[model samples]
Target: MMAMTFSPKFRRVSGAASGESTVRRMALVAGGAAILALGAVGGYRLVAQVEGDRGIAPLANSEDIQVNGIKVDVTAKTGAEARLEGWKLAQKEAWKKLGGPDMPVEAIDAMVSSVVIGQEQVGPRRYIATLGVIFNKARAGQYVGAGGATIRSAPMLVLPVLYSGGVQQVFEVRGPWQRAWAEFQASQSPIDYVRPVGAGGESLILTAGQASRRSRLWWRNVLNQFDAASVLIPYARLERQWPGGPIHGTFTARYGPDNTFLGTFEMDAGSEQELAGMLDKAVQRMDGLYRDALAAGELRPDPTLTTSGQVLDRAFAELRTKLMPKGGAPIEALPQEIVLPSSTPSPVSTAPAETVSVQFASPDAAAVDAALAAVRGVPGVRGAATMSLAVGGTSVMRVTVEGGSERLASALRGQGWKVTSGGGALRITR
Candidate 1:
């Protein structure tokens, strides 16, 4: 009230302050609008992905006995009649392949689950096609002994890796190789395959790069997710002669977390139209390679891939450190007599050591380690190592003992473990 009139400096200062406030208000509004726009775009993309087709559906009847490559040519008065005859012929041929006893067409049809047509051409009075016949294992087990009930290996995870167009992928997209494995019938194979139907997060987890990771922790987590004891990588690389032309594939059978190579083979397809068939046959050959490797003991799971293995390794390291000589030389470099402590007496068993196969239930890595530790604690036991590791099932170990398997069994029984003796192997349970 005392100074009603303001100076020109004061008026100018007031105008500058007003201009700064307006700019700040405008900037805040613009920034918020930009943030809202970005969020809207991000939300739209997420919604679209959630509603999209994320994976391929696996075959519903993978457990059936599949006999592929049954070709039939028949002629009749009508197309329907010829088709019917072709199907019946396929069933008979498939049954023969299974080594089943010959029976009437009606009986064979009763065992047939479904007929898969690979290729077909039906005329008014003729039918010619390449077909596959699927036989129900339950219905046909009496005729074939449950598809030859033989010893099957532990559950092996199948990772079908496809390399095409200079890129390697597994379960990233719906590729032909993935489809072939999904359609494969594992009931007849002696190797138990745990196939994943790459959906949602599975596609993200099982990439081609995952095969190269040697970290035991990572592998253990992945195997536990699928209840698999080991991993089987059926790798295929495709080379196209040109666009829409012939394709050549190089296939390899690899197993274990180390990705050890078992065998490799090459196959050719006439064109893209034949790619699927070639892949299907490649899978069959890959299975054969794995089966042979298992028989040769080359496909056993790596003991180091389990957590217990790491614990054992640490223990061994500490023991070696404690045994190291004052001169910093390893205990192995010392004389044999000097290696054993004076307080510990020498083993008295003069019997020659014999290797024995011991089977036990190993529901987890801890159980496997505990079983090995218990068996090793026996006085006559020289060494014990896991030969076949099945985390959620029966695991087998090869043990070398001084007095033979019976002595080892008796010792295990004294330790409160239930032991079963049969087939030259001892099955132990706690």
Candidate 2:
């Protein structure tokens, strides 16, 4: 009985049959792995397609228009021919969509810059595609009757803030509103816009929150940095009916250091395919609103920036009293006497021969004039001119003084200017 007993390991069927079964099992495993790998790749592609747009860059003299869902059926020698014809048809449609419906074929050909394919399908004798067409700005503007309005506006900084799906963002992320502004043809618009391309730290500082800041000093500094006279906040709130459904966009035009509300408009798109065009139209309408405001003189630069000799005189008189010696005595009777040097005035020098550099915080033109008058009001200061004028920031002025930089510092200090001496310069700030 012991000899008849067999271990389970050795009680198998024929070896060839075992090998065939093992091979079949391996085949099944490989097939499943292949299917899973294919599925993973397809899923990744689908996700990428869903979030595909990295946003079209702003073209200097071009306008982009989308021609969606163009289908063509024709008997051709090859599928490639059919696709090419379909693209041509789509491009023609794009021209029509851009208000060039009555344009001549030759004119369309001259105006078209390039065509980009979005989605395409090819069959034996049929083709379907979504095409993006870029048109020349100069030509397109003429066709759309846009260049007629003369834009004489001062440069204005633009902060496009988007509120979408319970999130508020500016240039922190690439949003559809930001993209629309980027792609907008500002040159054709009646509003002179100073649009930042959302680069580096500058964009983070200039945001939606900054728009609400009522501090004129802060706004002046920001405007000076960008060389803009004022700021524009174009806000957009998007509400979607459902995923991939109609989008309702509410756009509001706001401006100035005090975020004044200019106007608002409501727009909608049937689907995502039409969203970009809807946004483009919205931007144009916003520009038109700004144009109206500008015509009404509501978009003028800050009046506080005005400078005059009277302002300078008033500032100097105030500073003169502050810097004057106690008991109406001369500067020589002061605790620190600013003695004039004996150097003869050079022929090339218009006023005092010696020049002392004075740096001060000039938050506005008034501050600049005040600083200049304060320097010129000094006993031995013959003349003062701004060497570097950075309104809303630190400015440097070269003063033709009869004495040295130390005396200039003392004079500023006497006038209640917090003077810091560094690098042979007198730095003063209120």
Candidate 3:
């Protein structure tokens, strides 16, 4: 009789240890929920307008990738040794795909941000896996001879609208197109992408149709709510060659307040199995196209949308001065204006009410109504209006109030809502 010894490593290990002392293993595949949850912890968040909640901020420089069909075998005294070697081989291949060529093995290991296991098969002494790898941008770029710094453009909101199955939608339901954008790491590109998760009412307003809206005034208001300078509408029309067949996607890159057509590209997925990866690739290409347009000065933000508020303020000041006299007849009848005993109120000019966009998770119709009512019921809330509504997700409401977000959040807290403040927006989830 022969005895096999198996010992588990305390640090990091996955899968069941079999009778053999040797082990083969695999890692780095994540679903949309898992990826989004990761972002919730450390990713930069921007409150969505209609779909208010935490949104994944652009990675600024990171990349998400999958290294598939990894099959490697190593002869070692132990199965753990063989498994570790297989992972090393897979990481090396992924690094090469990321543009790191001829780099030292030790250096490549340091650039790996994370690894997730998608598929793994363990034989007596063999291992196979489909791994997902996220590379640290700064380190990977250095090894690949790519630029290290990101030249970010003015912030532009991303509305990834998909046309599929004879319907057009943006966050109305779960779609691969929107998921691809959410999972994308756009740090290396010149364009600063402001992507919303579209949890609620935001999706209702920031839709495919919004790309065609030419009113700078409307754009200005929308941009103000999201703190975006302009908008990018990356439209994808998916055409299935046949049922359960290849998917051909026609993508167009449009930008600016007017949604000017920049360019279009076509990509295809061999089958439904390839659709997700194909969409991810298309996003990267779309980002590259945007970067190219920016380099050529073709993607400039509309000044009308960005500076229009200041222009309006100045015009209003002029109008007020002309329509309303600041001085009372210059005291023409008196030699000297008698000063009152009261302290001279230094021109008591009223500050304009700050518009605060409040986002809350509404899991049902009742919750939505409750949130809207709670917002309106808050003291100092001048008015509240729904900007976007997702019946069972996050919703964004614009609140005109006397004080800023602090005041609104304080009030919501009183109502037993968990409020988190970020980037001048409030997210209330209960």
Candidate 4:
């Protein structure tokens, strides 16, 4: 706003300032457009990389009890007749492997679910094949006796980690180790394996690096997604003599968020053609290691990963303390129905009331309600609420009672609940 004589030098300076300002604005606009274009390209590449053909869908019906390596060779008047005879022979042999008593081929056939042909050659009057027989657990359980009735381990998420070419991966790519685990039939095993198909976000989440993370919070979140109580890591490291020559594999069985090692073994394959079979055998051996660990009480779910009863106990204690009167005295249980004079204040009783955590098996919603109702029906139970609900597994509930946990356990026992008390919590069952 200066009113003065305009000099040429001053005018030229002013023109240069305006030009510089315009150039800066134009540069900013161009830079922003370039950034946007780069961002778009980056986003497209990310999407393509994640959703690309990098996943393998697991085979369906993995719960069936499978018996493999049953070889049959038979000759009949026709190939059809020979094939039928081979299937029947395979079933009979599979029954024997299952510890079943001697029975007619027709009886074994009744229990057979499906026949998987591994390799087959059918001629006009002959059939030779290596076969796998799948038996329906429900139909075969009676004949198999206690093998089908054994206690199964808690749901353990299976992360098949492959270390090949100096790289570790789980669900990052479709590898032989993952395929072997996917093809494994788990119904006959006592380990409840929860195998995730390496698709979508699963590939991103269940990478090899995740196995090394010991953070309980992160593990809890991951396990919750699959409804698993713990994690099982089957580690495989492969070494090849040549591109198409003999290969050796080192397999280790690990469990829990801490990646505790259970057992390890090594296997060899004659060539790439035998790699799948080697992996399959390695998977079976790994499963046996896990089973042994389960028997030794080494495969239990990590307590920190599940709902912490101590947390609920502490929260209940805090609430109780806040509601207490000025004096540090135990709160009394009020009667279900009370009548008092309008002008009289309610009296405070000096009886002790403690919060008890109760854990029980909740196989379904009805079982949850039943357990709650049963616990609430107990004599000293002033209130009961579900702290954690894990249907088809153990669930936890918080019970505020007029007495301590032992008294609550005794009361529950008296009510026909099989009660086990420890660690300030009570486990009850029917």
Candidate 5:
């Protein structure tokens, strides 16, 4: 290191110079010094740039990666850790969160795999896993799209969103088996709910009037932590052979709530006490169901068994069927979206009485425009609008002829529009 010195050429003249002149000279000196400092900095920067250019060299070699694949070094020891066994537990939770109502735990586990931890070493070591999470996507999509529309839909709740295939790739791509296991454990269904989504608990644990409000409370509690949308449950039919003999049972299950069937479960002596307890549980189950579902002056069951005779004494024919047809239950994979409130009406009429939806083949804008014009000319046809065009979905143009909707459809048919009339209206062929 060396010391630098500066001569006081712009020195304070003190009493010799007037105060104003002295201040002005000091400022000029300071400004000059600043300019010199800036010049020195600029020169240093230029030199640094030149050195950097000279020092720059070709990059070193490294492992290669392919799409949907990445490079990683794996050690045999990390793959066989006992903690990894717990990973399945985490998978179960993730599955439960994913499964929603009464989805089979084993099915979920079987579908979603917790692959072993792997590692890669270039200079440092890392962990990784390839987890496969299989689910019923179509149903899931519906549930995701249609969650939270009705009072019954309160059970539909979705949790645990795995955006990737569990193998997150970054910094040598890794996922910890232990951490994965912890996450699996962290995920849980509404275990506290008597009947979780899809009424899973009732099918597994309760019998008789198990479809009561009390039982549903258990489901409500379990699903309480979850946002209402994530849960997706489906209604199903079961041919159950209990101690009382075979009963063709049917119930609607909220996703992950309780009623998912995982193969067969034996009631043996193992679950007897619990089974007996269900007698009272059944009564408790309906605690608020009847009151909640009742209309003005409608007959309702009391949780305290006040209306047992009324419930049981009902005409045999009437007692059997309530919500759905006998031997015909709504069978669909879960995550069936609770249909959201839609201002946009479906072009295809599902309502049996109000309107008819007819589609016209329109390959392009011109074709669609022509179809619209043709529809306008038809008698009784009030209005025609382009439902969808060019887009892959419902590319057919829809013309909703308004005058006595049914008559309009008939009139369109006479105009040679290929049409199928149903759902309270007609679908003009596209």
Candidate 6:
């Protein structure tokens, strides 16, 4: 009958296979296939959520990004809009690389949604905008596993900085990443305080033994809490004595490192070079007031040192000799030292230097006076006089020897008197 057909072949079995059993076997196979298909679909969805097309892909003909399977190139037909689209594509990639944990932007430079001043470069000059990126996403996500199962998407908001003039760099989506900049240069600060609160004024840090009520009051009064605040000092001042005072002591007082005098403190010898340095600074200050005064132009030269009447006549006479113009004034004096001869009383040169007595050899006024006058007679001795005489057997004498020196003893002996000497002093016996 028209090549009567058999649509299927059946295998002979030990017990003839039943139609119902065959149908059942076929149904089982179909069910198994469906399960496999569903499994594949589920796998694909999971991958999409994590990788998003492997994070980066070729825009044009970039080398297949082999790094962590990320795609790194975007080549869109270029125009402002097209380039922007390309940038967006690229940004998607940048975000992907930055995806994992608290991945700090290794470095960031940005361009905002403003008109792209095209592209420029700062650091890796060749490629122009070579961005630095580093992150640890997988670790980060795993760390937050306890919080829940879902991985958060990229940050919701990104404040990209638009740089107009020029500068090229890669930028993260963070607000801090964006900064205004010129091409081939660094960027402007996110927060620039042009004038800080205490920029011009000075501040002193106050350190006291303890922050008692009185100490706090003193600190507040000396330093203005509003104008300039004084921070608390950290360390206590250390004092180390050399067992004996100082080998050669030159002492000064300072408010810590500030040179102004606060009170006297010891400066001693040691390899401790700090002592020498500090001493030099202190002594210099004592002698340097004129310098400070000069800086402020406040030095009024002493009349005796300058062109005061007596001095003026002599200087004027010399200045006139210069064949100088009659109207010209004398040269200014620096006023190196202040001579206060007039402030006190001018001493009479004709009168003798005031005298006193020598107690050692001289027990009477005549003896002490003679000793004093003899020593004063010595050539180099300017003047000499004694002060007091001993009370008990110690007996004291105040003798003024003209030029204070040991030669006075010989002069006294030459004056026909016996002379003796002792610790830190001398004696004359008649």
Judging by lDDT against the true structure, name the best candidate.
1
User: In every candidate, how many clashes are there?
Assistant: 0, 0, 24, 0, 51, 27
> The CA-based lDDT of model 5 is what?
0.35
- Each prediction's RMSD over C-alphas, in Å, is 10.7, 20.5, 23.9, 13.3, 25.3, 43.3
Worst 10 residues of 2 by lDDT: 341-350
| Tens-digit per-residue lDDT, 89-114, candidate 4 | 99988899889999888888988889
- Leading candidate by TM-score: 4
For candidate 3, report its TM-score: 0.54
Give residue 224's lDDT in candidate 3 (0 to 100). Answer: 59
lDDT of 3 by residue, 156-231 (tens): 8999889999999887677888888987766556788888867666766787788788887788667756667788
Tell me the lDDT of candidate 4: 0.81
For candidate 2, give the lDDT of residue 400.
Answer: 62
Model 1 alpha-carbon miss at residue 204, Å: 1.4
Q: What residue runs in model 4 are displaced by over 4 Å at the alpha carbon?
A: 1-14, 57-64, 75-79, 123-126, 147-149, 309-430
What's model 6's TM-score? 0.17
lDDT of 2 by residue, 1-430 (tens): 0122333554345796786676667667777878898999899976654353233345463344333334444446678898777766766777766666676666776777777665667888767666666666666765665444374876788888899989887876678888888877665555778887775565557777897788766775677566566788999999999999999999999988778899999999999988987887898889899999998989876633222223344565566666655687655655554543324332221233477788889889999878876886776565566779998889998776755777778888899899998887888888
TM-score of every model versus the real structure: 0.66, 0.51, 0.54, 0.67, 0.23, 0.17
| Residue 352 lDDT, candidate 5, scale 0-100 | 32
List ranges where model 2 is wrong by over 4 Å: 1-57, 61-79, 86-107, 116-149, 270-274, 305-430
Locate the minimum summed-lDDT window of 10 residues in model 4: 339-348
- Model 5 lDDT per residue over 1-430, tens place: 2233445653544654665576677678778888898999899976553242111111221111101112233333445442343344444444454435555656544444233332222222323433323334343343222345322222233221111232311112111211121122111221211222212221222222222234544543333233121232222232334554433322232333333321212122223223222222222222222223222222221211211122333443243334234565443422346322223322332233223455555556566555655665664343344545663334544443434566666666787777675665455653
Candidates in descending lDDT order: 1, 4, 2, 3, 5, 6
- Report the Cα lDDT for residue 155, model 5: 22
Candidate 6 global lDDT: 0.34
What 10-residue stretch in candidate 5 is worst by lDDT? 61-70
Q: Which residue ranges in model 1 land beyond 4 Å of their true spot?
A: 1-51, 60-64, 101-107, 136-149, 307-430
Q: What local distance difference test score does each model get?
A: 0.83, 0.72, 0.71, 0.81, 0.35, 0.34
